[model samples]
Target: MPLTVHQFPCLEDNYGFLARDEATGLAACIDTPEAGAILKALDTLGWKLDLILNTHWHPDHAGGNAEIKAATGATIVGPAEVTRISALDREVKGGDVVMLGETRFEVIETGGHTLGHIAYFDAADAIAFVGDTLFALGCGRLFEGTAEQMWTSLQRLAALPDETTVYCAHEYTASNARFALSVDDDPALKARADHIFALRERGEPTVPTSIGLEKATNPFLRAPRLAERVGVAGEPDYKAFGAVRAAKDVFKG
Candidate 1:
């Protein structure tokens, strides 16, 4: 059975995910952005937090780890690097599988935003908790890794089935939409951007972007075409990716 995923806004624009495995009724929090918010969400949903799955060691992603673990006694599982920032019960990396009831999450190492970052993909459920690796109409900023590493990570994610529902960490679609519009002139892209704008105006969340939608609209995934769109078509794939990332870093919109 597909896992029931509940996504709620956390500190600032971050999103916290609670995935409930139907068969076992075991629920796992995807990240610990804020303990109070996550606990409240669990209380409202009537689910207990059995696991804390961290994507990276970034404070915003793991800041509430100790508190949440103390409150719920949830077994914490994440990349070994998380110990650098917070406490963890089990360490995981690429190629490992984490089970939530009958649901199996295949861990994929996606190092870029953080060098040890990983994403969890449940192929049966067609869901991916991508942390800050990828986003709606955008990708995470390269922090501890190079653009090439980030590009490699994104390629791995882009290989997932088009139907996969990506659960990225932040609410960055609004700004990303503006940047996407600034570069791409495709009518379909413009339509999506306009819709994102309208949704944001209504105080709606624009996350959970599908893989197909991102492949068609996200500049980072469309690295081969980005250089052409930005009038630098002769560059290599990594160069194009770097250029796009750099532009986005300085882009106010």
Candidate 2:
């Protein structure tokens, strides 16, 4: 059979997930901010999680690890840097592969949100679990790494197949798009933002965005040229990218 991915909302719009392989009954979680909610989602889907994938060390992304790990005995897999932040069974690097049932995940070192942020890529399924690196219409704030690192990270993600499904950790589409609208009133972005705002108004999720869709509208993903323009006297690395990102940081819709 194929893989079944279930995305459940938890902890103030944060997302927790269970990706299962029907053929082998192997399932895993990308992140679990709340064990109770994640466990419930698994039960609802009749899944037995065998693995835990942590994208980074943010509390909202890994806060439920101990509880879920205790309950399911799932092997914890995370960025190579996790060894410094959390107890882990394995330390993974870019190009490393993680298996869950029938699905094979390719790890992507997409830092910037955190120095060790890693995005899980299931190429065959066109699915990506990018913790907080890239959102639907914007990118994560530079928490640890510089803007250059984040620019490179987003570029790596953008290089994935256009059909890839982006499963980021938060429901930030509406807000991100609001910022996008302020930058340039691109009709497409405004329209997309309106759709997401309505979803928020009625309590809905805006996620699993396609890479192609994001390429068309996300302001952060489209900042290479703008970055070049904004670099402070062209500082070569951080300043160049920082200029563009800083603008987005201040954009108000």
Candidate 3:
């Protein structure tokens, strides 16, 4: 059976995800951005949380670990770095498999926004819970890692099957689309941005983007082709990605 994911907004643009393994009715919280919201959702759904999966140690991502654990006694599973902020019952790294009921999530190392950031991929269902690493039309900033590291991390995600459904942790698509339009003149992106703007105007969430959609329209993923626009002409793909990241850091539009 496929995993059922319930996404809800919480805490200033962040999203809280509750994934349920249908076969066993086991549930897991992708990241605890807000305890109250997560708990309320769990209560409303009447689903028991079996695990708390942390992608990193960022306050918004793992800050509610203790509170949620206290409320539900859900075992926490995440990269070792999460201990910097919350309790981790199991330390998972890349290549590790985490089973929630019969659904198996393959841990992927995506250390860019944070040194130990990780993503969970359930291949059977083509679903991925990507913390802050890869966003729709954008990617995470290099807070504790290098541009090269971020680029590599993105590659790991981009390599996933195009049909994979990506669950990113924020609702930054509108802003990211604005920045993307400023850099790439690809018609595909222009159309996608228009769609995104319309979605936001309707107060709709523009998440759960697919890997194929992002690989085609995301500016960061298309950085190599836009090397000249970002002033990294003739540079390697990673360098082009770095230049694009730098440009986004200061982009006012």
Candidate 4:
């Protein structure tokens, strides 16, 4: 059976996710944006929090760790660097696999949003919980790692099965779609962008975008395709990606 995923909005624009393995009644929180919201969701589902899986050391991502762990006595599993910002019961890295009942999540080190950042992918479920690494039509700002690192990281995600559902951490899709439109005017991209606007305008969530959809529309993932628009047509992968990120950094739209 597929894991049951419950998504809820948390602080400001952040989102919290709860993935449960129905067979074993085991549940895990992908990140802790707010303790109150997460605890409330658990209460609603009558699911005890067995694990708290963190993606990075960012405050918004790990801020509720202490509170949630205390509330439910959930074991926290995250990267080693997370210790600098929050408590962790187990330190995982790339090539490691964490079990969620019968479902297994493979950890991939995607250090671009933050050095040592990681994302979880479950092949059996065809889903990924990417904290701040990749988003719909956008990618995270380079807060710690370099463009080269980010490019490599994004490629890792893009290479996943096209049908994989990507659960990102924020509601930045509308803004990202606008920026993507400014750079790439492909008809397919326009169609997706229009859909994103409609979804957000309706106060609906635009997350859980597929890897195939991102491959077709996300500017960060399509650096080569956006190279000309970003003014680095012949640049290397890193340079092209860097230009796109730079443009996105100051883009008013």
* Best model number under lDDT: 3
Q: What TM-score goes with each of the models?
A: 0.98, 0.92, 0.99, 0.98
Arrange candidates by TM-score, descending.
3, 4, 1, 2
> What TM-score does model 1 achieve against the real structure?
0.98
Clash-forming residue pairs, model 3: none
lDDT of 3 at 119: 99
Q: Could you give candidate 4's per-residue lDDT for residues 1-253 as a string of tens digits?
A: 8888999999999999999987898999998999999999999989978999999998899999999999999999999888988979999998999998888999999998999999999998899999999998899999999999999999999999999999999999999988988888889999998898999989999998999999988889889987888899888988999999999999997
Q: Report the backbone clash tally of model 4.
A: 0
Model 3 ranges off by over 4 Å: none
Instruction: Give the Cα error of residue 142 in candidate 4, in Å.
Output: 0.2
Per model, state how many residue pairs clash.
0, 0, 0, 0
Model 2 — TM-score against the truth?
Answer: 0.92
Error of 2 at 165 (Å): 0.6
Writing each residue's lDDT as its tens digit, candidate 3 over 94-201 gives 999999999999999999899999999999999999999999999999999998899999999999999999999999999999999999999999999999999999
Model 4 global lDDT (CA atoms, 0 to 1): 0.93
Better structure of 1 and 3 per lDDT: 3
Candidate 2 segments whose C-alpha is farther than 4 A from its true place: 225-241, 251-253
Give the alpha carbon lDDT tens digit for every residue of 116-152 in model 2: 8999999888899999998888788998998888988
Score residue 217 of candidate 1 by CA lDDT. 87
lDDT of each candidate versus the true structure: 0.92, 0.83, 0.96, 0.93
Put down candidate 1 lDDT per residue, 1-253, tens digits, no spaces. 7799999999899999999999888999998998999999999989977899999999999989999999899999999889998988999999999998899999999999999999999999899999999999999989899998999999999999999999999999999989988877778889999999999999999988999999998988887787976666897787798888888899986
C-alpha lDDT of residue 225 in model 4: 80
